[model samples]
Target: MDEFLEKVFEAAFKRESEQDENIVRSLPFFVAALGLVLAIFSQVVVRMPPVGTIASAFLYVLFGSATAIFSNILWCLFQLVRARDFKLPPNEERLLEWADSLQKFHKTGKRTRKAAEELAIVDVRRRLVEAYAEAAVDNRKSNRHKFKYRAQGFMGLVLLMVLASASVGVIFFDKTWRISHGQGATAEAAFPPPHREKRIDRTVRDGEAQASGAGSAD
Candidate 1:
């Protein structure tokens, strides 16, 4: 009964540990998502025009930054490999060897057999524990094989945003500028007469010219 209870408690503890591990592994992605939203609001939805243009640069920067974050994540996969097959520390190996020596007996054969089976179980648990720890590392980061795809995802979203903004600007402001130009033309059409005299008229006919010249010279 005591042995059964011990096994039950061990199983329960293992389950909880697994849950904690998964949460830890997922934290990076959660942080990335949170930053994404904050960045969008800060760089986008909150305002418009001149400032937005300046902020668009940030979209590109964010993608590059996210890639950098993911690259570090790839390095973590190596840690997982290390945990799985890499030699255990001295104390751990000694303990594991002791367990392996115990697995040689069958329960029906002798007391030693029971101890051996227990040892085997312990070895299995050891391997699983290593795997669990390795898996607990954050997965939101990108390895070299997966990096191109993540970069594409970030850049694609930014490009789409830029296009959407441009489309909206053309929709909203293009007509307004056109209307303003039209009104300016109409105002010029109604402008008052010339600011200065365009000509000074001097008219002289053949007979009138002859009389004017006869009096002028004398």
Candidate 2:
């Protein structure tokens, strides 16, 4: 009985320890990924022009994505803290004492195992198993939460990329429009209209006739 209980406790402890280690290792990756996303977002914002109606719509979407990413990052941080502080049942000391007693009994062979002590040990083992089971469930839940947040963060990143691309396209389109309009204005400035040219010719003829008449009179 003691051997079996010890095996169970060892297995449970190993499993929980591995889970903690995994969570600790994964936290840095999450933080790094989020930081990269934020940096890319900031670069995109810096290059963005003043927002018009269409651009405003894109900005709103980008804002929502940013909010989601940050929220997920906070959640991941909270989970990381919780994982770091994970512990076994509070009666762990009592269980360890029972295990020690059982060990000592097997070694000395001087005293017979009391029925009450055996029952108590059995109860402790059962509680430990239950605690381990609960911990396993919690670990699984935490993993699912991590996966969900990661997916959301990636989705936000995709949305940000789309927003950036759309903004660039709009900027290019506006620049082209301005260039075309400027070229049209320049062409008009370089060439006078037909009506203006005709008016100028008529004024010159009148002035020449007036000058000739004045000279004849003199």
Candidate 3:
């Protein structure tokens, strides 16, 4: 019975370790996703039309808003990858001490060989159960936190992708507007064109008047 219980405890501990390893393995994939999104976002921004009109202004604000949201999501992913404390097996030295104590107790004529063996198994089993319980509880909590963060990161990435696609659409629309308008739209286009004074040639007018006067005198 003790041996069977020990096996069960060992299995539980193995499961917790595997869970931790799985989370660690998933980190690289998340990082790669973030990098990909960042690259695409850069392209979108670089190709965005200049921000002089109402549409371009709205696009700038949308990009800024998307960036802020994405940053929060990135922080969540960072938290998921950050180091956390995990419980390990009972110390070997401590287990050895318990075994030695059991031997000493047996040598004092307090127990027969069979009884000593049974007691040793019972003591070891008790220690294993305690360690397994503590580790299982602590690891479960850690795993829950990791799972929560992982879910948040995943959802955040999805939202970011949607926003990025929308931004691309807006950029395309802006480009189309610029193309159809001859690319000469200015911020001041909202106002009328500037007025200029029409200049007159006073010297030419004065020479014409003098020639007419001399012809009349002749």
Candidate 4:
């Protein structure tokens, strides 16, 4: 019975380990893709038209979200590195010792084992299995956390992409509107003409000349 249980535990552990390995292997590719997208979006933002306060605030939010997602990805990578080195519980060593003794005794064909010894072996095996099951549970919890972080990061990336795309659309739209309606000429018209300033200066000089003539005549 103990052997069967041990085999089951081993199989489950192997499956989990393989799943974790696959996740770790795929993370680098995901991180690289996200980073590339972020870089492209950053360039787009740089080329975007000047925005008002509201749009600038939105851009700041997008920047912060992207930075947080990048940080989360980095943290997940670090966690994967740490999780690769799994450590057994301290009591597991004693359980292994007991199992070894039982195996040796059986191999020697010893038929005079005490009832207490047999019970102790059974208890140790049960405890060992329990310990492994607990460890597996912990591993599963960690995996869930990894998934959650990745999901959040991806969501943030998507949001940033959407915001950047919208900003780009606005820029193109504004440019088109300005061109279609001759807004550029209107903007030029908004400024006072240079000739007006020259005329004002000429009027001031004429007034000063008239004043000087009157004083000379007096």
Candidate 5:
């Protein structure tokens, strides 16, 4: 019975330790998601011009939504990584208490020393079991909280990516609409092409002047 109890506490401790390591390993993925959010915001939102027809107006709405989603994602990732009450190994105070109990058991009279040693051992085991149980419960709670935030952040990242793609499509659609409607002609009209007639006249005048100057030299 005692051996089984020990195994249970040991398993709980090991499981929580593994969970803590996993949370650390998963942090890089959260950071990568953050970078993706920034990349999409800059490429699809910040650089896009404000001038457009209906598509541009729709894109503006998407940009606003994306911005808000990314902000929330940032908050979620921050919560996931932020420091919290993670129960570590048994502290010095507990270890010293165990040692003091053992010393008292040894100092007892020789007749009771053997029994005292057994009781001390059981006491130490009980303390260890309590520590493991407490740490496991608290650490599991912390892990659950972190995982929840991470899940939220990951979903937000997926949504932002979709919005970015949609925004790109909207931009392309607006450009196509402008071209089909000849809305881009205004810029061409504003900067009219140079006169070919004026160029030809200048060329002729230069040729005549060059011929006259060469003839005089001859």
Candidate 6:
């Protein structure tokens, strides 16, 4: 039972060596930074939002973060998959082996550093250099567009916002023109107030003359 428990603990909360932990943490961070920039460039911002602005803003942040994290994950996965296709570089492996050899030489003080140097390690590095002479094809940068995996939804939303902005501009223009025309109509209507006053004055004078003539006849 104790052995089983120990195995379970190892599976659940296994501790990574310090070097491995550093590499794991740093690699994710470095890879994520790339996606962060890509996501930022890909995102669109909205301004002068309507009544539901706060709610919409919150939704935007939520979706945006999810997209950025997903993108980061995708980027990390891509790198891992690509690296898997290529066997561990001989140079990298040899470099590690050479360090181990140096440590062993130091521990066994009887052995000279020259005797500790492995010819196979030198040959490994040499083979790596000769095999890829002047041709270092970094697949990530070279086949960047090969994935054909785009955030279509994100781009669609960006274009939709642009169209919406143009639509709003058109609406505002129409309303402004309508208000100006309405004001002109009001001014025109007001211009004939003097004519109305003249008609009213003539009516009053005619009535007065009729009343005076009627009194004289009586």
> What TM-score would every model get versus the actual structure?
0.29, 0.50, 0.76, 0.57, 0.74, 0.26
User: How many residue pairs collide in each prediction?
Assistant: 4, 0, 0, 0, 0, 0
Model 6 RMSD in Å is 20.0
lDDT of 4: 0.64
Please provide the root mean square deviation of candidate 5 (C-alpha atoms, Å): 7.3
C-alpha lDDT score of every prediction, in listed order: 0.47, 0.62, 0.76, 0.64, 0.76, 0.46
Model 2 quality (TM-score): 0.50
Can you write out model 3's per-residue Cα lDDT over 111-151, one digit (the tens) per residue? 77888877777887888887887888789899888888888
lDDT digits (tens) for residues 25-89 of candidate 2: 76676667666666766765654444554554666676676676577657646755553334455
Best by TM-score: 3
Question: What does candidate 6's lDDT look like per residue over 56-134, in tens digits?
Answer: 4554554466556556556644543343232123466767776676557554766666655554345444544533332
Report the candidate with higher lDDT, 4 versus 6. 4
Q: Alpha-carbon error at 194 in model 5, in Å? A: 22
**Candidate 3 regions with alpha-carbon error over 4 angstroms:** 181-218
Better of 4 and 5 by TM-score: 5
Name the candidate, 5 or 6, with the larger TM-score value. 5
TM-score of model number 5: 0.74
| Per-residue lDDT over 110-189 for candidate 4, one digit per residue giving the tens place of the 0 to 100 score | 44456546765776667667766666666666676766766665565566567556656655666577669887466344
Q: Model 3: what TM-score?
A: 0.76
Where's the lowest-lDDT run of ten residues in candidate 6? 12-21
Model 4 alpha-carbon drift over 4 Å, by segment: 51-85, 88-131, 184-218
Query: Which segments of model 1 are wrong by more than 4 Å?
Result: 1-102, 105-111, 138-159, 183-218
